[model samples]
Target: MRSEPVPAPAGDRRSRATAELTWPGKRVGHHAGLVPVPSPARASWDVRGRLVCGERADSLLLRADAGVALAELLAAPGAVDGGVKLCYLDPPYNTGERFAHYDDRSDRAAWLSTLRDHLLLARELLAADGSLWLHLDDSEQHRARCVLDEVFGEEAFVATIIWQKRTSRDNRKAFSSMHDYIHVYAPAGPKVWKSVRNGLPDEGAFSNPDGDPRGPWRSVPMNVQAGHATAGQFYTVTTPTGVRHDPPPGRCWTYTAPRLAELVADGRVYWPRGGDGKPRLKRYQSEVTGLAPFTIWTADEVGDTGSAKRALLSEFPGLQAFDTPKPLGLLERIVSVATDPGDLVLDYYLGSGTTAVAAQRLGRRWIGVEQSARTVEEFTLPRLHAAWADAPGGGFAFGAF
Candidate 1:
């Protein structure tokens, strides 16, 4: 067993109580103003409840302080040395609202200063090829972007993804706000980043009607857009059906004459039997690249606020409602795009643990940090435990600073 001192009280000048906490086979000692500790630790309980002492801890970690946990992660040798693949954060929006545990009200200077500190630490934690996804509302997105540009540099800016967070309009307000912005940044430019592709949806359009030996295929237009045509793209062609055609009024052939002839010889061009339709290119399913991720994410593509609330209610019955919990589908989409299986993901705010849950479902390692003991005990930890029980492969360790 190891013993350690509890943290000193914050902003209290009076003489304070102090106690030692023992771990690895003992109960934690009670101290004034200390957060409530869990019951006697067991084999299944990997909750550290204090700073981790030794190596060989689980990849899934739940820490009680963002600053302490981030500092520890950066200081740990080889733990996060150019290793973290993605850092996704959904910090408090500073909307001047009161939550169950913390107040969202902060002066502009204090809020920006706090965010700047966190962003600086987070930038250090990112690998050369790593990316950061910061979620925020319109209230402070511009300011946040300025801070990010300062920390990560203007050249590191990637994209601002707009997520449609709601479907129904609010009747009380003059303008119903229904979207949230997710700012993405990379330590390095596009060369070090990987492109994210969405799975191809099954459609009846793909069919090998002619039984081509290659595979099922679909016909796509063989003309470039009106304003995007190059000089070499303007051409005339005669199809196999003996029909002569020229590039459309403004549009041009998608391929040059030589390329078109080569494709025709290779049986990759499709000419209609009627000899009247325009030539088309046969896009084989085997050669198709998946759909690239786009900036606008509709509610159907990811999920809405209602779905998120229902998911939380279903996951943990009798739990108090969180004011703004992100949908699992939304986080799942972000994780799927930003990382691969076994990559490290960090969520500092960890409001309802949606990020951790999404990472777990996708078979990625994750770390979550939250300051509220009530949240960790009642919502985050239990939700993660339930997710693990449902899947039963990966486990997590809990710690405090």
Candidate 2:
């Protein structure tokens, strides 16, 4: 493999001039830094420190520098253009805190430059409608957003989602921080990205009180603001029970007169007062895809950091839990939203292999790259083996470079 800074490809629109976040060693438009050579041999692991040879594995874990592994993947002959659907990164926060697994300290400019290198490679790995989810806290999210905007255009930004990572408050600090930020960016426009994104399954919003043959359904108001209404939308509606209702002030019927009549004939209209009140439109459960995701994610919906630690403890007893391991539910939500079955997921900062496990459980192909050999052997491999054994179908190959 080559050991040189790889410049952005010719004719890439990402090189266009825009406001950039300045750093001492910033390479500007170039993807700076050399990737380490990945080891040639690939081995399989059924559990921690146990090797299983000659099995077909669909996923991979490369114990090498993130940037290096990414470069190798790009250079592979089997690499597909626009192949990876999602890149979920949970890199070192550079918070200046020493942990058992990593040294979380680095110069600001150096860290940003390193992150820029990874982002550039990740960008190259993305599909046409792909997305990048960057997870960070207050440590460097502001500066990270600048780098993201510079690399993936400000117009590509989707949303800044807030995830409640903890429910308990720390009395030692002035104000306990309980949330983490997940910034989403898509090179494709937001609309195109969202069109491909999956929504959370609807929960407890549908019911059938009338025992309709169609099935459980939910009702919505049949009126909308009259500002853009046509003449037909302002017509009075007479219900089947002989009660006449006029379009409310500044509001008109959502449907035209003919459409409303057709709906009423088909028994798709719900009356609030036992079949003699304001009519509502019936939305059948079979017609619903799912509930649209919102900006805020509560710990109740997705497990908190504490729960993640407990899960790790239970999964691999006697092993030291990662200080900042992401909850499985959090990654599941992200994977579900960003990819479909068989789509490829890339996580350069694989850490404890949470991204790989999430992708595998959700039926997506994945590649995880981590630098720490100890962490890979102790935490990543064991956890992945457990996940693989529980969800037995696909296999993964592991290698140290």
Candidate 3:
């Protein structure tokens, strides 16, 4: 098996905007050169009480090159076509560094080409509402975005979420780079994905102080910027106590005068400061949806590198930890947002198997592909075993090419 990245020969690097990203050895299709598809070795290992087989399973840990494995899956009859709900990729950032499990460095062209191939296959594998979340650093974030925009279409491009990977400062460098970019893309376009996308659990404290018939509720701002407001939305709002109020400067009421009257008549409006304050919309618990996920994720909310490393050490003492491992919290958040229970999640670059563990625990089926067999056996498998012990029911099948 090849351990190091295949190097690309030097060639002209000029690129045309209309032609997409041009690089040396850039191929038109998903397969990188002539890749020999390896047959899956039907091997079984004792994973505690969990079933370990080569047949269909709730989850799969395939030990093979991701690009080759993706091609094979795509070609399989009635498999992986519009089925994957979410694909979370934590591929190499190509920082030109060699690590314990795998080499991080690769030629820019080769790296981008490999990524594009995987993405192209992933696109085919994704469901109609499926989405891809790619974790990357500044090293290739811009270029990767360009590639995603091309492959997934510009309209399918979602938000670029900023994750604070660390909080400590690196005084030695010119700047202390602490955050990582998670680029999201939906194959069927953002609008389609948004309709099915899951929202974060609302952490707001709701209460019904007025003892309304709707039970517990929370108030939301009823004023919006007057950017494109009609004159009908600029009327005064009278409270139950006959206090008249106008829209604040540069802001207009969220609803028209008639609509506001209807809401008020329905007791959906709340007045603060003992019915003296400005009106707000009262949203009942049953009517309230989950909070929309934020573009910025703090390290505290999602574990950072230090916390992830510490957790690894706690799980497996005296083990050589991976150079970079994503936190379980980060994967959990992604899974929760992109998939529901029973939805399939794919992670081709399953480095340390955090994605698998997270998906399993969250009641989502997953398929992980890792090129390194030793890493799978030594690191990924054990972590999964521990995770399975806690949430037992479905067992994962393990095989290698």
Q: Which candidate is the best by TM-score?
A: 3
lDDT by residue for model 3 over 159-204, one digit each (tens)? 9999999999999989999999999987666665666777887777
Give the better candidate number (1 or 3) by lDDT. Answer: 3
RMSD of 2: 6.1
Ranking by TM-score: 3, 2, 1
Q: How well is each residue in 60-166 modelled by candidate 2, as lDDT tens digits? A: 78788887677677766464444788999999999999888999999999999889888888887787677899999999999999988888888788899999999
Better of 1 and 3 by TM-score: 3
* Candidate number that wins on lDDT, 1 or 2: 2
TM-score per candidate, in order?
0.81, 0.87, 0.90
How far is 232's C-alpha from truth in model 2 (Å)? Answer: 5.6
278-375: candidate 1 lDDT, tens digit per residue: 78999988877555567899999899888898888887778777768899989998887777677778898997899988888888777888888877
The Cα RMSD of model 3 versus the native structure comes to: 7.7
**Model 2: which ten-residue window has the lowest total lDDT?**
45-54
